[model samples]
Target: MEHPALIIVDVQNDFCPGGALAVPEGDQIIPIVRAWAEDFFRQGYPIVTTQDNHPPHHISFGERGGPWPPHCVQGTLGFALHPALQLPPHAVCLKGEDPDQDAYSGFEGLVEGPEGHREPLASFLHRASVDTVYVAGLATDYCVKATVLDALKAGFRTIVLRDAVRGVDVNAGDSARALEEMAGQGAEIR
Candidate 1:
């Protein structure tokens, strides 16, 4: 596809091993994404890295009656991206910041792109003339899946880098099911 952008979703400390909402082998995708990010950056393609930065009382928190434990909380180390991921200077998107809403898709997040101002991901991507989205990063069943679905709905040619993803699998085989569902919904699983 032409004008492809790389969307790395929620590769944060909290989703890695030993953190609050660890995804199995989640950190394992770091090198894969790092390599891809470097290539995309060198190619002058847009690279968008995402974070799940949430307020302490975010609606998705168990403390607020949601199923998930308070994770990726603002100002906490868990909210930070993993040190080893080494992404280039690219757009940064923040999700789960709204205390009243739980955002899983990067499309729902706001991007702090080269403009140095926040705008919706879809708008930023569109402004960049992005016609395709190549996705990577954590939790295949959750954020990655959600991002892919949204990208397709937004009418972009969406592709998932299967080698660069892992999942929490809150339920057994959820990750596998997510990939199938995404493909079924028009996302190419590469």
Candidate 2:
């Protein structure tokens, strides 16, 4: 069996319904993600959660002149994880906390900081002996896409659970195009 790691990316309140940057029907993925998490937990596979922990004045928010609205602010109710997806001990990986940076990929922060880089994923998977990674979470057009791309670049076999993700479809075909791009990059979308 391929040694697999389940990478849950950015299932935060800010990406769900009634959120600042809410994707259409984003909460729809919660049940699916929860089910997958349960399966991974039962199978004893390694699981890692990626959180978009942005500061209050994050550059990715409109308050900071970003196109998007305020969201995922650090230490706010908007930053909380989805209620349905259970987080076990040590499964969390936080990023995008720097108000100046915007990190979409779980493997690495978007912009570099002076406090030395934080790459918890590469070492975590290597130490856990994970050869393949199953990725699922919100905003397929953004963070989910970045995470899968980085996973492939890291030389890990990658799979994106299509049913367990939602996209920030700004336009009509944004989500579809995003999926196509990811598939073209050798990501198995299921």
Candidate 3:
């Protein structure tokens, strides 16, 4: 039978409050995400996570003329996953490792192999027989939205855990608009 998985996108420290690029109330989702993960874990469903791992001079950095402040740099505390957010054994996909890749979508990220090789998001899910994916994470306007859209494009039934998300809201209503866009693209906000 095809299994369903949970994709926890970009829940690292930097996206939380009191970090270099904190999302407003981003830390609020931890308990909800943890509860969902635990439920999925108990059911033997796979839990996949995404991290924003970038170099100091990543192209998305404002120092490099990109829009946002420096955050989630590789090897920094900001790059660490939120401490309060616990998980069971899960696959981790690291995004933005390459300087040129914005990698907003977890679909654009990769997971490590036994030999230190990397695997793409869709490939891993397909290999694991995952037919549906539920996404919950930071910045509804950006990473979460991108991941959900890509999941749909890759032909996976996608669901967005509405209460388990927060957004940077660079603009006043970007988060609301993003939810609409995701819903418009066939992703259900549950």
Candidate 4:
């Protein structure tokens, strides 16, 4: 049977309030995400969490001339998932670890492996026979937007939990615009 997967994207400390690259009220969604994950877990569905685990000199850091401040550096406290999120050890955690790649979508992340091969998020879902994906997490305008679009591109039925996401909102209305774009591309905005 085809199951629905939960893609919780970038709910790390660095993205939350009082961190390196804090999104306004980013921590507010943790409780909701945790509750949703628990429900999925109870139903025996796959839960995939994405983390922006960049290196100290990652290209996405403004200190390295990127657009944003340094955040989610690997091995740092900021890179860890928020303490309040009680995820099971079996839950898949995909990390974007490339120093030069800006992996906004969880599906686009290049996780380090023994043979240096990258594991795409879609492959995991396909392996588990997942045909639908429910996404929620920090920064709706960026990571959430990218993940939802990629999910649609991968032929999965995608749904974005609007109340369970926050955005960087660099342009004041970026979050709203991103939701519109996602809706336009066949993603349900719940």
Candidate topping TM-score: 3
Q: For candidate 2, give the lDDT.
A: 0.83
Per-residue lDDT of 44-163 in model 2, one digit per residue for the tens? 998888888887778988877887888888888778897766655436678887788788899874322237555567887887899999998878999899999888899999999989
**In candidate 2, residue 3 scores what lDDT?**
95
Task: Report lDDT (Cα) of residue 101, candidate 1.
Answer: 96
Model 3 off-target regions past 4 Å? none
Tell me model 4's lDDT, rounded to 2 decimals. 0.86
In candidate 3, what are the lDDT values of residues 1-190, reduced to their tens digit?
7589999999999999899889999999999999999999999998988999999899999878999899999999999999999788888999999997698999999976567888999999998899999999988999999999999999999999999999988889999999999999999999
Better of 1 and 3 by TM-score: 3
The lDDT for every candidate, in the order shown, is 0.92, 0.83, 0.93, 0.86
lDDT of 2 at 18: 87
| Backbone clash count, each prediction separately | 0, 0, 0, 0
For each of the candidates, the C-alpha root-mean-square deviation to the true structure, in angstroms, is 1.2, 3.5, 1.0, 2.2
RMSD to the native, candidate 3? 1.0
lDDT of 3: 0.93
Each candidate structure's TM-score, on Cα atoms with residue i matched to residue i, is 0.96, 0.91, 0.97, 0.92
Give the Cα-based TM-score of candidate 2 against the true structure.
Answer: 0.91
State the lDDT at 10 in candidate 2.
Answer: 84
